[model samples]
Target chain A: MSKVNIALDIMGGDLGPHVLLDAAKKSLEHYSDLHITLCGHSSVYQSFINTLSGDLKARITLEECDEVVSMSDKPTTALRQKKQSSMRRAIDLVEQRKADACVSSGNTGALMAMAYYVLKTLPGISRPALISWLPKAQGKKVLLLDLGASVNCDAEGLFQYAVMGSVFAKLCAGVESPKVALLNVGEEDIKGNTLVKHADQLLRDSQSVDYIGYVEGDQIFAGKADVVVTDGFTGNIALKSSEGIAKLVIDELKRLTTENFTARLLSKLALPFLKKLYQRMNPDQYNGASLIGLRGIVVKSHGNANSEASFYAIKQAYEEAKNAVPDKIKTKIESVLMEH
Target chain B: MSKVNIALDIMGGDLGPHVLLDAAKKSLEHYSDLHITLCGHSSVYQSFINTLSGDLKARITLEECDEVVSMSDKPTTALRQKKQSSMRRAIDLVEQRKADACVSSGNTGALMAMAYYVLKTLPGISRPALISWLPKAQGKKVLLLDLGASVNCDAEGLFQYAVMGSVFAKLCAGVESPKVALLNVGEEDIKGNTLVKHADQLLRDSQSVDYIGYVEGDQIFAGKADVVVTDGFTGNIALKSSEGIAKLVIDELKRLTTENFTARLLSKLALPFLKKLYQRMNPDQYNGASLIGLRGIVVKSHGNANSEASFYAIKQAYEEAKNAVPDKIKTKIESVLMEH
Candidate 1:
């Protein structure tokens, strides 16, 4: 891969710019050909720059921005008012081709709005979806899209998402002609609302997508399909619900294993395995949700993301940049739409 | 508690009528004051009747129905064509006042349609919702409604759900002035789609409900509110997604524990704790989801329910019947709406 550059929105995320700065440093060390342009308050970068070696310092660039898009900021306000914000600056870097991708752990809606305003959608795509990889059976991952980018999606919007997700699964997840499915309440032909049912038909008729019918929420991790597409509302709730349950289970396990001396001793042996399981299942570990169907690559990390999670987001941006995800999606969508 | 009479749809569920019959027997054994009216193919009951003691036999009544509502049957077809079906007959028993509640593991849509047609909605309620209990932190459970009964709910519909859920939480879940919340992508006032925002305003304006603002999917199990209300699509997907992740975690743990002899031996001590955790978290074990906003109580079990799960459904029906949940909801909705 050629030099993959990611513009990091350091002022964004709950842990603040310091954590993101640490992640940026870690990411540079991990990816040999990766370059990071830190966009945030200049003072945080100043103190951190002293620790980096000459080789590392030479690769990193600081693009100082005065404003920060807080987690509570409305998307419209962030888009119209926060032009000089760190999140906007990061996306600006991507648009200017100074960075191949933009990574932010800021407000999702604001990031999305700014990205849409700055990067614009790819040709043949109506909207850009927040696509993320979810763990499936056999150590495989499935691509779930529109995780909160576009809430009230019409049938055509959902159909576009299907094509985009299929393209993403193939290009980014390394699946060939990825089997795509619509997320509905039931797998039956007569299931779901009008939007999903219509989208299902559109997907079934498409020659470009390997449409595999519907999969309910419980079947999401059953390795039923390579990509699952749904409107942002359902997708966001489903994703968060999965995270909630995973956390609940982990908490319950922790409580159970320490309830008694016998349990504690037994759990000591299983601790390593438990840690590995946590790492695999934790949503924080799966750090980035890339805004696909756009002219430029933009990865949105979780708002509450720590340094580790932020590093994973940078890593995600590096991979997507290397894969040229947006270009592939644009190509795939154009070919798929032309068939109709 | 008085003798709680429950009409059982024996011919429904994946395990066939035999599993329901087993559940009926178990329910009768567990709840001494409970009487069951079995509505299904009489041949299944006739053969088993010989083994029952006179005391148990006297408490049971068989209401023979020729037709069965299959899981795949459309709601309209089940309502129009299958009047003589087991599910319909069970619901009819409730309508006729022969049974206090009806229990079914049949098609949810079919059950909802038949129940709505036969029993009708409460005085101020427009649509019925499938309300189920979800485990929260500290051994508590939160009430999640509209699991798949009503899709495409408007602001008024969602607001009504909030009111109904609040009533249910107070009466059934034993919460005083239950805190109600609308489930959305984010907790912010600016978050969520148009329906939720409108509903939030309505809920806030209402004096009857203890409206606690919006909650995200991850907070559903965090005990943030006593009741969580959402449209059927989001609620169903969120629920099934939670189930999927929980199952995945369990499956992963099983694989990890059995990977080596040391791990296997260690897990043996933690086996009981794990089993308890599974029981608490498993969706199958939380068998019944009651249809609220109706004139009568109708508990819908999982279609693929085992005898154990089916028994829990029967137990759920018995409790609802004893509590006169329908009457309570009717009074609550009428009183709450009258304030407007």
Candidate 2:
């Protein structure tokens, strides 16, 4: 409830800096104790700053950067070359202790690389992972991790992810002794690739994790586990595939509603309920994917995020900052290592 | 059209033998020229056969087996022991040329193992792949391969899947020159693990395939590519995740409609269109997933398939048999190898 300083890459995302600036303005209005450090070009910030008033003006600061990380820029290129980039500057703010957390809707790989280079991983953690929550039935949420940060994970990496994810679910979702499960093709111990099979054994042997058995993709939203862990490659595909199917269903529903008079009338009558359903199932609501296991908190928003989604990402950073997620995760991981 | 023969495993699937029997009866009723070789306990077949008359009785033949391949049975167990299992016997019917193709709704792993052991791979194909078509928008379907057949696929395995999938799209889906793509986390050449990157280069250099660039999970149903290829781990997760989301959407819709009286009446008005949409997007309609790159045709139905879904699996077997799919795939792979 004290002032939470959050840094955001204003020049990031598919839309121009104005979208991020608008989100920053909205966040400033919504959260009275929130302070924002906007990292982007000075001209964009100057024009926006001229319109702000006393308290609002005092809460906002700018770190002018000369370069922008484009969506197509490779991770290696972004890290080695774009040192003065907005994305890098935002992460740099977090590392310099000027911001409690940093958020970006820029290129995911670039943001991840920059965060890894600047913020670094915590002790007892080998790598940072991309973790995000998705809506489950009955208004609950399931946290899925390693969305795309580290592909080709070993048993050790997967075991570490399990530990990190369990901590995240407990802290963020408030699940006491969060049930963690490994994502595989089938729930059986015999299913999936060798990596998962080995990871399964490691998870089962670990006393620190409240490790449940394996869960398949179909069980991800069935509320079987508080946290579902997988390698980045499989996790990314599963997440994106769900999004694709959701879009397909929505498009089909849209087409049906406009097809005939009866459907049109039905759609009109059912508009409120439909909107509620859409809101419940909307991907935009689950916008921020935080890079956990780092020394500093970093939330990566979706690349194609709209203003609302960008605001949600900022909210995520604020919450993570308030809770000091990275510190908590570090403590939890150390305890888990002690258990070993 | 000549008489197409398909062997059905009477004792498979989550449902009992009666479901497969009902499907067999339905297939016989629909296709007058179709002959079915039923593999299961003779007592079950005898009771069913008593009701039939004339050509219907003569068209159906029984291959009695004492054993059954349970869903819990390991692939190795089914392959080594249980040679006379209903599932194995059904496959044997195809191998013996008594039936053109066979259908089983048994354990996928067991079915794959049995089919590979009995029928063996085609001359140039290293391994078999599980492939099925998903409904795309505008009444098209996209073919996805290695659904759970080969978990750890190398670049050569992927390149072979592309060749087989391309041939499948052409022969089964009736596309002239199907556009084939490798599934990845991103669409760029620089994205994904090393396996896909190597496969991309191999696919690009191949003359046999009409290779499109990489596609992300969201593009699976965008109708952008005719065939999508990935290792079994990612493919299985992506496929099941899409199914999970589809089920989630449907359940949410049902909950919304039944929430209030107005919503109920609106649902009634939209009932016809909803039914049509459900039918079009139904997973049951796309039930059978054939194990390609084998010497003979074998269709693996979902374990939890209903009567309609089981019938669709049998139908898939009939079509694959009619098309001589294995022979076509063999020919295609040989040409691709010859080109190299």
DockQ of each: 0.80, 0.78
Cα-based lDDT for every prediction: 0.87, 0.89
lDDT of 2 by residue, B1-340 (tens): 3999898998888888888888998999988889999999998788888888777888998887999988888899889898989999988888898889999988888999889999999998888999999978766789999898988889999999999999888887799999999999998777889899999999888888899989989889884899999999899999998988888887888788887888888778767877877887899989999999999999999888999999999888888888889888988888888999
Each candidate's B-chain TM-score, in sequence, is: 0.96, 0.97
Best by TM-score: 2
Alpha-carbon runs more than 4 Å astray in model 2: none
lDDT of 2 by residue, A229-317 (tens): 99999999999889888888878887888888878877787689779889889877899999998999999988788888889999988
Residues B124-235 of candidate 1 have per-residue lDDT tens digits of: 8888999999988877889998898877688888888888888777777688889998999888888888888999999888898899999999899985798999999889
- Compared to the true structure, candidate 1 yields what TM-score? 0.96
Superposed on all Cα atoms, the candidates' RMSDs to the truth, in angstroms, are 1.8, 1.5
Q: Model 1: per-residue lDDT, tens digit, A60-160?
A: 99898999888778999999999999999999988998889999988888999999988999998888898898887766778888899987789999999
